[model samples]
Target chain A: DKKKQLQQLDNFIEGVLQEALEEFKQVE
Target chain B: MEERIFGTECEYALFHQLPPPSAQGSGKTAKWSGTSFSENLQEMSHLLVCALRGQNRPLAGEFLANGGRFYIDRGSHPEYATPECRSVADVIAHEKAGDRLVQKLVEEAGGLMAEKDIPGRLHAFKNNHDPRGNTYGSHENYLVSPRAMEKIQQIIPFLITRQIFAGAGKIPHLAPPAFSGEDWLPFAVSQRADFVEHVLSDRASDARGIINTRKREITRSGDNVRLHVILGDSNMSEYALKLKIGTTALVLRMIEDGLGDIPAFLQPVQALKVISRRPAGVHAVEGAGSGHTALEVQSIYLEKALGYFSSHAATGEEKAVLCLWETTLSGLKNLRISPSGVIEDDPGELSRKLDWVIKAWLLNRAREKKNLDWSDPHIKHLDFRYHDLDPETGLFERCASLGLVDRVIEEEAILLAMEAPPHNTRARLRGGIIGEAWGKDVEVLVENWESIRIIAKSKVDGMHPFARQRRSVNGLKANLNDPFEGCNEALLKRVRRFLDKCDEV
Candidate 1:
């Protein structure tokens, strides 16, 4: 369970940054 | 007074001039020569006055058919309906009207016109001397709850992107029937302005296509549940100009409402204009045509407002900018009613269905902890709940994923219970907030305990307002008896529909 929680934490942060990056890409 | 009442009852206003008849040439014995533009306008105006006086047609017609057309100039907006003048008889009546105003101006100018005293001189007023342009336009929107923006932002970009699909393609050039290579020439650009030009110019273009493809046409599916606006007296203060700019303000609010899924470009566009919640530095795009019906003019002003607030997002005043945007589209002309009873048009029924969707979604979302609900399989693990939640293979990630799996399973069941397009309800056109669609919905929900009593209380109690104390605050004037009392009636109905729908499942 600890392993899964830690993994999810990493994935979530990764996903947020990815989405933010995706947002930034089309701005110009 | 009778004439005024009769004119007001007419269905639509004409914004364009009708083409002159084809058969009339310069030298032919003047047919309908007595029917000059000035005479027609005078006749029309007189007809109204006479009708109001309870005069019958023959007498009213005699007053209207005043001798002939008069050519006089007034610096009125082009869209203001003014008839053309062609005869000497028309000139006399026209000069008399002009005399009323011109006599007050610098006497010399008025005297010179009197001396020149010819229909030709009066007609000169119609000449387009100053080319610099400005637009006369209208803005429209429907009222939705404070919470609608968050949901709408998730879907508007998808609507914007599909413009090409719903819009007709443009072809610039034309070939003969037997020429063979192509039937039409396509335009270089696909945005609305360019499309409007091509459609208007093309002989092959179909009018129905333009109407059907308009973005203003409601989307059959989306988070947009309402559209409303306040028709400002444009002659009023700069506040009216700001009201004109409210469309962009609304877009900014939608961004802040955090419905997400909106296109990225719109986010920064709104952010760049927001300053401390008060929008500043918003600027309209330059060189947009000032045509009354031009979307370009509307969009330009809207963009300017967004730009101003977007560049100043760091200030505390930015908060008020959202308020400015929230009331955008408060005034409009066409009164839409979701009909009642067993009648059968789904479009008419959209208001209640949309109300139900928004209310249901909000309730469902409010009950959850995540920013985006993981109820659907398509949305599984799509949201991050807390700062500590990580995504690189941990228990939290698995928990999130497992939550999504359970939600997706649950969502399938919920979707089954969800209503389909048109939702099997009928909408009818009725007077104001009293119609069947709104009336029944309100009747069903007004007694419910969980309803937003503030909305009802604001309408009935007037003294206590919902949002707060400010320039927009409701004083004793806010009572249900006030004209704005009618505005809340619709809101009350929508709230009721939402509550009832929520309780059904």
Candidate 2:
């Protein structure tokens, strides 16, 4: 159960950073 | 012993990402100008200050109804000093509330800007350094006894290692690696480590050090002094903030109770820089061990604190701080970063609880995802955005929205802290005074942390009998000399006595 939650977190963080990077690029 | 008082002063960085002239033609949202730090940030800060309703201080800042202070510090950074807190939880709630307060002002200022047709998003970041290598501060203030002040050096080793958990993490241009040249350090554990040049210096802006020796006498009894700490980073994580303040207070308590003979760093500033830049490496914590890492030094402090508090009565907060301190150290023991500055292994739960860990993990993940190096400008932007205050665009806020990060304080508590001061400390009186004075038909000036001065708008009736006879009334003053006193009926009486007579009311 913990591992599954951890996987979800990893996905969440990656998605967040990915979106942030792309958005930042457009502004730059 | 008198109830220990704790406070945090955070100077938040203002970032304006102005859309270029070419992008103005497009429908996309604005972002930071290619410039590292924009000048509009200062103007935007001014807008926030101007939107505040009443003058709360004689200076440029306002004394908040929450018993806190918000003002623009040098370099035009918006700063918030949390009300004096006796508990770690209050500190966390109030500190986070500062972020909310500034953010609310940012929106107000943005509205003001819209009237002016300013074409950019004003992003306020709770961070220490900008991309241009200029560093500000997130200073801590604790009321320690005169005895603790004498043995202040005993706390240095613990502080130097405290960055293992308390650091807000930064990606630096002039990165410090143990070896120079091609060995590029892409990220550091601390934002202010490179700027700190001494162990104990009275100076703050330059020759910065572990302890800011500029002292303030808190009580007339000469029992307590304000230990102004300028070494830490502005943290976004409530858990990190709690542990940072909690453990530092505990160590200082131990020092007061005579927990002498702890480890000391031979070269304090040098060790701070090296350990911050290279935490996972085999760096010996001098005066402690041949193989003692930063983790070891921190553990020694924890164990000593544990021993002392085991005999001495500790609050539930202090006990919890000890547990978190230990767990964080244990978690940092497993922290893994490659020599090239990519995080090899991110501690799962600790990443949720600490600012630096989560930041390092996210930045490392970004680097690996795009096959980018540590020095990539894209990664740098993401790094800067991690501290961004906007809930929609901030990377950390995004993670928080998804419940990826662990929270120590409740959302309700944070919101309440925006207007209400902690009930147990002199902040309550200060907040009450500020609250009573707000919107009252009086000219009020908060002279400093200790006193609030108020005068009536109407001339004759507002005056005291003596002042009326002499035709000389400056104002009524409420000077809260003792921080432990939470209620002042006399001050409230004076508040009523003056403001009630005002015809403007």
Q: For each candidate, give its TM-score against the true structure.
A: 0.21, 0.89
- Candidate 2: give the clashing pairs: B17-B31, B17-B32
Binned by DockQ into CAPRI classes (incorrect, acceptable, medium, high), candidate 1 is incorrect
Where model 2 places Cα greater than 4 Å from the true spot, the runs are A1-28, B25-36, B54-61, B176-186, B217-222, B282-291, B340-348, B462-474, B503-505
Each model's lDDT comes to 0.24, 0.77
lDDT (tens digit, per residue) of candidate 2 on B31-66: 334433546667777888976642232221377888
Candidate 2 CAPRI category: incorrect
Q: For residues B1-505, what per-residue lDDT tens digits would candidate 1 score against the true structure?
A: 0000000000111011112334445442243233122323332332223332342211111111111111221223211110112211121222222222121221223233345331111111111111111112121233233365335433333223212111111111221243222211112111122212211111212221111223332222233332322111111111222222223334434444443322222232222112101111122322323212112223333454455456545233334434443332221112121211111233322212121111122222322424432132112212111101122322222333543211111333222211110111110001211222232222211111011121222222222332233222221111121111113445545434433443332
Weakest ten-residue segment in model 2 chain B by summed lDDT: B52-61
Question: What's the distance in Å from true for residue B146, model 1?
Answer: 1.9
In the order shown, the candidates' DockQ scores are 0.01, 0.19
